[model samples]
Every structure is written in structure tokens, then in C-alpha cells.
Target: MPATAPDLDSRAAAVLGGGATHAARTYRPAIRVARARGSRKWLVDGRELVDYTMGHGALLLGHAPPEVVAAVRAQVEKGTHYGAASVVEVEWAERIVAAVDSVEQVRFTASGTEAAMLALRLARAATGRDRIAKFDGHFHGWYDAVSVELDGAGRPVPGAGVPASMAALTRVVRADDGDALATALSDQQVAAVVVEPSGAHYGRSPLQPGFMAEVRRRCDETGTLLVVDEVVTGFRVARGGMQELLGVRPDLSLFGKVMAGGLPGGAVGGRREVMELLSPADGHVVHPGTYNANPLTAAAGIATLDLIVDGEARAQADAYAERLEREWRCVLSDAGVAGRVWRLASIIHCALDDPDAQARLPGALRERGVDLLHTSGFCSTAHDERDLADTVAALAAAVRAAARVRR
Candidate 1:
């Protein structure tokens, strides 16, 4: 095996600027994926890898899932985008409504970011409030208004390009601090609270039992609306996303990733009266998109839900997660590597907590025939015990290789 990866740098730089189409994948070098199928991806340089990225949490059923592919193939023949309404869209919403306890009305978007933005708009319009509050580690879409702060020096620093004025309208609070949330809500200027119920993306933060209940209590006590961002946690976490698992209903919820079965699709679902504001008939808010409810996405989304509704696959994935999460921790410990295995059900994050850590994990893992998912790994329905054991060993070896490099 070559110590230095091949064609990754030049090819990426030549075509994709900064070596990637998306900022996250760019890293410093580049990550080139050739093709994927069933829990794995083959790299362009001829390396086969156990893929934990899985379309960045989109492939709940795993790569090129049979049902999802069939749905896409069938829909493509009927034509991809009509820029018009279709029955597939209606059925997609119906499935979402049935699965989630809080959703009565729904709107589709091209990405989860858009769904969240729309959710915020509707919340503000309906509540007649100007400010939106969210936990520190949670990331909503990249929209300027909501994307305006990062926890710097234990205080909010205005995110670049976010007007200092608009910065004042957005409030940043700790995900665990119920008192701070209450204060923001009491301001009466807060329109909504958007949260990732499991706190997966925010440092893999774990919400203490009843933390969600506290949030629900706070929202009800004040006039604030709650928006749960389920882009990463939607189907994979559980059938109805974190809301169902936690038993605390929010006023609005955003869905993406696994919801599309690995296609480009997103949605905002919530109570009827609030969502009614999005209807053009009502003089409140607006929701529009070129790819909104396109037949291809709708078909793919419907197929994805069909596979998730029964919760059998979810159970399998969660079981695998428990096994792998524990095994990885053990392996890392045995290797004398310093890190912690942080997980939320099937979602596993290996935080490299060591100060001496100096190697890039994606490169090290790729060299060992396994794909890296931003320091985390998700177990798919297709990953059985065999895959889990193999991955744990692979990660153990990769950590040794990484630890060998001179800082």
C-alpha cells in the first residue's frame, strides 16, 4: 500500500475548487469517493471502504438501497422534475404526518436548511416575535439570520457577514441550561426555539433525561414555539425522529438526510394553525423552491419512509450501534489511545480528546479500506455483526497508524 494516497489532491483541485464541492468534505487535502453500494464505498484509487458517512446520514437503508433505487428508477422514467404538483408529494406528507406526533401540516424543501429557515419564518409570523433562540452547539441551516453566532470565549461572537444589527435579533443559549432558555423565552421577543433533540451534532451532546421535557415545559409556559431539527436524527435515530423517542412534541420539526433515502429532499412539519401561515391564501408567510416536491425526490422519500415505518430496520441499526460503540471504546482503550466514544443510538462519534493527536482520521481510515464520517460512524440496517467487528478492528489499527505520525 502506498504511504501517500493517489490522485486525491490534484484531481480534486483541478475540478472541485479547494478540493471539494462542499466545504466540509474539502478538509485540507481531499476525499474522493468513486462509487457506493450497501454500507460501503469504493474510492477512486481502487480502495474499498466500509462507509460510515453513508451520504452524510442520508442512507438509512444503506447505499443504493433496493427500494430507494427502484423508486428513483421508476420515477425518472415518469420524468424527474415537473416544477408542478404531484400525488407523490401529497403521499409523502401523509406518511410524515402519520409518523410524527406533532405534525399536522407539512411543506417540502430541497434541503434541511431550507426547511429550518421556513420553519423559523412561520414561527415568527405566527407569533409576531422578532428573535429566535437556539442552543450553542446546534447548527441550523447556513441562512444569515440564524447562522450568526458561534460560542467563542464562552460568549457569542457575530458570525462573519452577519450584520451586527441582525445579530441582536438572534439569541444563543446553552443546550442544557434550562434557566437561560427560560430567560430568553420570557423576553417575549422570542418566536421559536430550534434544537437537535439528541444533540448529536453539537459535540455529540447528550440531553439528560427530562431535558426535553424541560424544554417542552418551557415552551408551553412561555409563548415560544419549538422547532426540532431532525436532519441527522430523523429516521435513523427512530421511526419518528428524536421527538418520538423523547416523547416531547415540538411546534415544528425539520426533516432531511435519511428522509430522502439518500436523495436531495427536505421538509418542515408542524401544527396546522402555524403551518397554515405558509399557505399563500393566508397573508402570513411564503415557501417556494424549484425542486420542491419534484417527482424523483418525492418517490425516493416515499420509498425511504416505507422502509422505516415498521421500525424493524431501526432496531437492527441501533443494536449494531450499541455493539460497535462499546467495542470501539474497548479497542481504543486497549491501544492506549486517548479518545471517547460518544453516541446517540445508531449515531457514533469518536471524539479524539487527546492533546497530542496529530493525524487526519479520514486519510488513515481510507488507507485501511474504511470510510470516515467526520470523526463519527453510523450503523445502517445493512451492517450486521460481522461488519461491526471488522470496523472496530480496522479503527483500532487506524488509530495506531495515526498515533505513529510525528506531530
Candidate 2:
């Protein structure tokens, strides 16, 4: 017989770090998912929970959409890896170039982190500058070069294991602060100005209107390449991601998540001149990865991109998120809780006025059979009227429970 949830948790604790695969997934009583489909997951202990994580923003169409599943299954029969270039990858690249205006060329990577690393390298190579500037609270992946941020004193603070010398190469500027951003780029020693066009942490604290355009102008003035990290926003927020919505073209854009159709893959797309830095004939940046644009990921990415080409899938997901956001606000108001819910397309973030209450909210929601990605929710096209009703019901219960605990 399969081990119970508690038994699995105990065994996991003995082997896994903090009994969780990812740090964000750690909970006091870890919930074990047996299987997930559509907007719901079944726990090992037989409890059914409404799922809002949605593959950490990868499943804009929801878990295992038939088209994507069929694509992967068909490709699996061909082979997972050809060990050489395949036609599917070219088709995938063509889809990205056609969708995103800023992306004239595309280079696939194993994950978003690799994409980020490659993008910075390209920026540095193209500009012949070593320093990189980034907005405060903008996450570009777990790489050492992009892991540094400002401390309370506004000094660069590198993450553990990141060298101080390496951190010095990254100039941290506050998001939406045009003066500080301008100052960061005025030196002209900065190769790239990397940003998340949706703002920091996927819009928990959104950029003010026109902030991205301002950043783009500054980058142009300083001869710095603008690298927009669209890993979370790509294809989920729109068919072309945030850059399309904002009408701001970047020199380079990083994409993952929805573009890969719930699979593990990412790409750096940008102007031909900058992206060609990876080409051996004209440039010297050589990137080699065994699984880069492997057959399986290419098939899934192609299928996902095909479905979202017309933008209807993005519209459906956004509409669902809009309803969920409204219902969340109504729940907070009804529960007499001090909190606010905001959204960026399909991603929803819930914040309580009381920090302690906010901290307890996730646990409370889980108890009511609603699972969120951290404190945010990722809506999908697969969510329907039933999911809407059940999610609102769960939020109502969870808010009341959190309020009682606060009292």
C-alpha cells in the first residue's frame, strides 16, 4: 500500500530539505498532492483542494491540456532528445518571433535561470560593459550575478555564496524611481538594465504607469541594452507578454513559464545584432547545454504557443482572474478584514493589512481546501464557473478563520 501523507512527510523530512522541494512550498503540515487536473488537486490523504498555483505561472491553459499532452505524447514516440537539432525547435522559435515584436531572434535554454544568465552575457558582450543594473525587488532567477539587492541602508547586499566582488557588478536601483535609475545608468559602464515590466515579484508592488517606458529611454541614452525578464508574464498576460501590453520594446526579453506549456524550458529573444552574439561566425558567446531545446520541450512549447496565438486563451484566463480578484475583495470586505487584492492579467495577489494575519492566511486557506502559490493565485483558462464559486467560498472561510485567529 502507498504510504500515508504523514508517513510521506516524515520520510521526506529525513531526506528533503525542510520536507519540501522548493522553499516557497514549505508549510508546517506539508500537503502532499497525489494528482492534479484542471483547477484542482487531490491530496494523498483523499482531500480534494482547489489549485491556484497553476504550475507556478506555467499553466495558462491549466494542467495537462489535451493539445499539449498529445504533442508531448507524439514527440515522446519520436524521441525525447535527437542529440542534434530538430525541426520542432525552429518552428518553436518562429512562433516566438512572430508573437513578440522585440524578439527578432530566439535562443532556447533549459530554464528561466539559464535564460537570465545568457541574456546578461549577451548584453555585456554586445555593449562591452561589465556592470548590470536592475530594479529593486525584481527577481531574475537564482544565478549569482543577479542575486544581489539593496540592503535597508541602500547598499548592495549579495545573497549568501555570492561574492562581494560579483555583487559590485550589479547596481541596484529602486523600482519606478527615475532619478535613481537614471543615476544608475549615467555611468554608461552598465551593460544591461534588466527589469520585470509587470513590476516586482509579478505585481505585488506594480510599477507606476509609464515607468517601463522611462527605463527604456534611459537605457537608450546610456547605450545600455534593456533586458526585460518576462518569465512570469510571457504568453500568460498576453499573447506577446507585458512588453506588448505596454508597447515598450526591449533589446532582449527573457521568457519561460507559459511559453513552455507547463514544461521546463525558457528562451532569450532579442534584436538580431544582440542575439547573434552567440553565433560563432560573427560573435564569441558560446552556449552549450545538453537539454537546450530538446524534442519534448519543443513539442510542448510549440503546441502551447499554437493555442495562445489568437489571444483567446489569454483572455479567458484574464477574465477568470478578474472575477477571482473581485470575489476576493468582496470576501475581505464581508469578513471585515483589512486587506486588498490586485492583479496583473491572470496572476492575483492578496495582501492583508495586518502582517501577522497575512502570514497565517495561507495556512487558513489550505485548511479550507484552497492551495495558492505563496499568497498569490495563478488563474487558468481551464478554471470554470464551478472553480469560481468554490474558490470564493474557500476564501470566505479562510478569511473568517484568519480573522478569528487575529482576534
Candidate 3:
């Protein structure tokens, strides 16, 4: 191992922008992971961290799960990519269709960003409309069409390089504002209203209980297609995703993260008529990618889905998350930290009531050998009691550290 992360960080910065490929992984005192398995990862310097990033909410079974690894290993011998349709892709699609209630047909993409883009395209083709509506703070992806930030008045402010005209086409509304949502959809100009069903940024700011149902009702009333971006929640929250838990069906569903079983893959699954727009028979839409359904990703996805479809993995993860949430709250109380912990399925969000403490919490936890995504933590089936105990202890220490800084 190198003496410090600087050598690796320099090499990364030389090749990759900001010394990281992903914005989230660009943490200070940069950590370079060498390998990961189960609930932990080792840095290049051999420091072990009980991981809560969990592949950015992709690895519900944890890193390098044996079953998924075996599937990928076996498929490598046969072929990596065929650049054409394969049996594995067909089987993978079938699994998704069977599991997701709204998905009658499925089209694979390289990432969740691509899936969101395709969902919007399909909605437009099917509805003959050009505009789309999305919730503020509900991130779909980095694509220019959806990479919009809301202003004080809730109007969209386009990200750099995104044309103002394009941003204008996307109507932005607060997730919980039923009146605003109804008004936006009532115009009949929106092709689809997209949302992260698990609320903004995967439950960082939780949505009200009936918000989803309200969105669905408004979409139906206005004939606007409902597009649920389940890229993070699908298969992780339940076999059918947030839809399964909420009993609300969408016209189109965006799936990634857990859907690909830790591999880089995504899909747009939904009504047959809308999805058929991609079929070349009518030539209405053209969707193509070099790695649309690479055999390796397909094999891994198939194995992962098989385990999760039974709901065993999800149940275990949710239980662990509940325990962590309860224990975290208790730890905060015992430490006299002004904070609260909440959960949505296997995902947990922690907030120090104080803004300064909240800002410092994640870094403090990192210093104590625990890694979280911002102030939130994701629980995986592979995370055991020891991991939970360690996390609680680390969180308590971090809270105390933040309190010290506040003092």
C-alpha cells in the first residue's frame, strides 16, 4: 500500500476529472478502495470500513455477492458481449416483467440515466405531447432534459450547458404540493410526470404518505403518463418496488441499481403499447446501445433477481435497517445529540437537528471508520449484527464530535 492516498489520488486526477468518476465518491481525504466483499471494503492501505454506501444503493446483497459473482464468472467463459440479442437478456427481461406489475415490456439501457431519457421519449411518442413534469429535488439523472434545479418560485433553473428553452419544457413542482401537481398536469401539455417514488434523493426528504396516490390520480385525470423512477427503489424496497408497497401503478417505470445486481445496467419497463414504440416494425423510436444487455450483466442480474424475488433478501435488509434506525435514535439520545433517524425499507436517513452538526456528521463518521452517503445510510442483507453495533458506536462518536465542534 502507498504511504497515503495522495499518490493514487494524483494518478486518478491525472486520468479522471476531480480524481473521481462519480460526484458522490469525491470525498475529502480521498479514500481509494482496493477490494470489497460482504459488508466491508478495504482501502489500498489495508484499512477496513464497514460500508454503508452499498454501491450507491445498488448492492442490496452487498459487494461481490457469491451468487452473483458465480454467475458472472460462468458467463465470462461463454462470452462477455454478443452485440446482439441473447438468451440471458430475454430471461432477464422476463424476470423484470414478472416482478414489476406495471411492466408489460422491457427495454434495457446502459444506466439509469439512459432509462429516464428513454421513459420520457416513450411517453412523448405515446402521448403526442412535448412537455414533462417532475418534482423538485427528485433527481432522475444527469441528462440535460432532467438535470434541473428548482428556484425559490419552483421554476426550473437549467444546469449549465442545458438550454433555457429545454428547461422551460420541464415543469417543476414540489413533491408534496397536490395543488401544484394537479395544476401542472391539468394543462394536458405534459407527456409524462416523472417521480422518484421513494421521495427526493431516495428518502433524504421523505414524502407524505398519500403523495404518490395523489400524483397517480392527477395523471389519470389529465391523461398524462405516470413515470415512476424506481432506479434506486426497485427490487431493493420490494420485489415490485415502491409500486408494490404503495399499490399504485405507473405507465412507465425506470429501473437500475439493484435491478442489474451490482452491474452497470438499467431499463425502461412499462405498458406494451408504449414500449412497442421502440420496435423497428413501426420505426417510431430507435433505442440502441453497445452494452444494452451484455451477457455478463444479464447473468449477474438474473442471479440477483432470483434471490430477491422471493423477498427474503429484502425482508432481511429491512429488518436490519429498522434495527439500525431504532438503535441510532437511541444512540443519539444517549449521547445528547440533537438528531433523528428514520427509515424507508432498507434505507436510513439521519439528521442532526442542528445544521452545522448535520454538515459535519458524515465526515466525523468517516473519521471513525464508517462511510455513509451524505448523512444517510443504506442497509444490505450481508450487514450483520457486528456491522450494526460498529455503526451505532461510530455514529455515537461522530455525533459527539459534531457536538464538540458546535460547542
Candidate 4:
């Protein structure tokens, strides 16, 4: 922590249990952001950094983009929360339904976690099954039912505070293991099979190209619902999302991040019949949130979606990410560092073959004025050639620093 940060560390420790709201933000020598614009963030102590975290994979248009900010500012005067339906919410849902092929109806939630939970519940209600299947290492959210990891025997193991009984309800299968997936769903006991279409951990471990199609096939064969968790990839990877890129239609899609235009909101959008279960007419399921489709988020979402519906922003961001991937590979090669840089759409994943390099890379890059989420980076439409050059140079320096430390 910088001395000039003015008690950010102590304030964080006092207020935030882990000295940070999110685990990823709890880096040693913590940085407190004072403000951000475009692809850069200025720390509280006045240190400027080229940011790649991009709101933990939100902000597809980049930090505080003028249009989104303008919409939010305009909506602030009207009201923040009405606790009732609004035209903005209806318009937001309309855009989502129009964009996503599988979504005929949509329901809003306060976060992706809630959206996912509701999607699963909807699945259970539709299928009359209690079990859900998921790919190993595929993160849906922090919710207990979806937070389990696979054990040595490929069984689901719950995270701390999550009951083993709840974990057992989730069947974990290996990603890309067609046979395991088939076997898991063969019993027809599962209500849904959920996955991140961008692969596990948002492309840290990328999925095979045709694996999702296979999932779709298996789901159809087993009469199981396929729930695509597109919280990070929705509207960021493509206008419609990874489902559009892959040409697979999920029964239910969980969306957030870009969908809310950098605001805090999420949605469960899918087949009308399944989503209609939440309707009070039948009263099949109860779903409500104080901030669900709040006017501010709705306005921001509409504005953001309007710009990206043409796919220009997404294409530009993807092109930028591709360039960064190529350039970073060259950077690692030139430095005699062993690392791999790969990308999916606007997201970039870097993995150093050396454990020491892997461990030190993020901190080293931060010191060199670049910030990434774990080993990944997200490009935005706001990221330009200058940002790319700065990021590559910073990464190269970080690689060299890690090598020196290893020596």
C-alpha cells in the first residue's frame, strides 16, 4: 500500500472483512481506485494504471463510458428505485428477448448469483427433478448449490459452509468429457445442466470448440434443460453472447455484467413456458428483488445495448484482444519466458509455464502500471493502440522482473 493512499488499507480492514469486497481485489500492496475512464484507472494515491480487469469482466464498453454514464445520470433525477414496474424495465427485457434467440421471456435479479439460482429453480419446476449437473471447474456464482468442485473420484465436494447434502444434488462432470456428461445425464434425474459457454473460469481453461454442441445434443437426448451461464460473456463476447458464436441455443441463459451496463443487475432469460412459472397467475414460483430492473440500471442497460446491438463494439474489442494475445506471446518469447497467451472474443488468458512466473506475474504487472484479473485480461472498445502498447510493455517488464526474481 502506498503511504499517500491515506488509510485505504486500514479503512478496508475496518469495514471489509477481508480488507477487500472481492477476493481478487485483496492483492498485497493493495490499490484503492479513486476514479477510472476508458481503459485506465487512477489510484487514490494518483498512480495511473492501464486496467484490464474491466470491472471484473463487466464494462465491455470500458470504464464509465460517456453514453452509459449519461443515461445513468439522466435516470438518477427520475428515481433510483421505484419498487414497481417501469417502462425502462420492459424495454430492457424487450432488448434482451430480441437479442437472445432462446429467451422469449426474461426476469431480472439483483446479481448473476440470483439469476442463476432462479434459473435452476425454474429448471426444477419445469422438469420435476431435484438434481442439477455442472461441469467441473465451471463457476456459476458463490451460491452453495453451484459452488462445489470435483473430488479425486470426480464427485462433487462442497465449499466451506455448504452442506455435503446440497453438494450431492449437483452432479459434476469433466468439461469436454462427452462420455461423462452422457453418463451423468443418462439417468434423466437432473433438472438442468449448467455451464459457462466461455469454458471454466471464463476461459482460464478454454472449452473445445464443439463441446457445447455436444452438450446441447446430450441435453436434448436426456430431456434435460441446458442453462448457459453467460454472466461474463453476455453481450461482451457477441451481440447475442457465446450462444450466438457457438450456434447453440440453451433452454435458459443467465446474464449479468454487460447486460446491466456496468451496473449491479442480472437476469434469467429463457423459454417463455419456463419463465412463465414465475407468473402470479399460476404462482408456481416466487421471485422478487428490491433492485430488480431498477430504473437506473434499466436506462443504462438500454443505452449500452443500443450501442452494441450492431456488434461493432464487440468486434473492435475482440480485434484488440486478438492483437494483445499475439503481442504478449511475442513479449514472452523475446524475454525467454515460457508462457501462453490465448483469447476468446475480448477476453485474454495468460499462463506462464513457470510456477514462479505465474505466481509473480500479476503483482509485477501491477507495479509496471497494468492491472489484470488473476491471469486474465479483458479488452474493451475503449482500449486503443496506445493501451495495447502500454499493456504489452508492462507485461514484458513484468516477465523480466519475475525471471530476475527466480534467478
For residues 1-407, what per-residue lDDT tens digits would candidate 3 score against the true structure?
A: 35567788888879997778888878777888888999998988778898999999999999999999999999999999886779999999999999998999999999999999999998998999999999899999898778887989756799899999898889888889999998888879999999999899998887899899999999999999999999999999888999988999999999999989999999999999899898787648888789898898899999999988889999999999999999998988888887778899999998888999888888888888898999888899999989998988898788889877343
Question: What TM-score does candidate 2 get on C-alpha atoms?
Answer: 0.98
What TM-score do all the candidates reach, one by one?
Answer: 0.93, 0.98, 0.97, 0.97
Q: Write the per-residue lDDT of candidate 2 for residues 1-407, one digit (tens) a residue.
A: 87798899889989997778886878778889889888888999999988898888888888889999999999999999988989999999999999999899999999999999999999999989999999888998999888988889988899999998999899999998999999988989999999999998888889999999999999999999999999999888877889999999999999998888888999999999888888887559999999899889999999999998998988898899999999999999888899899999889999999888898888989988888987999999889999899889888888888777453
List the candidate 1 regions with Cα displacement exceeding 4 Å.
1-8, 14-17, 200-203, 356-359, 405-407
- Return the top candidate by TM-score: 2
Which residue pairs does candidate 3 place in steric collision? none
lDDT of 2 at 297: 92
Clashing pairs in 4: none
Report the candidate with higher lDDT, 1 versus 4. Answer: 4
Residue 398's lDDT in candidate 1: 80
Error of 4 at 57 (Å): 1.2
Q: What are the runs in model 2 whose C-alpha is more than 4 Å off?
A: 405-407
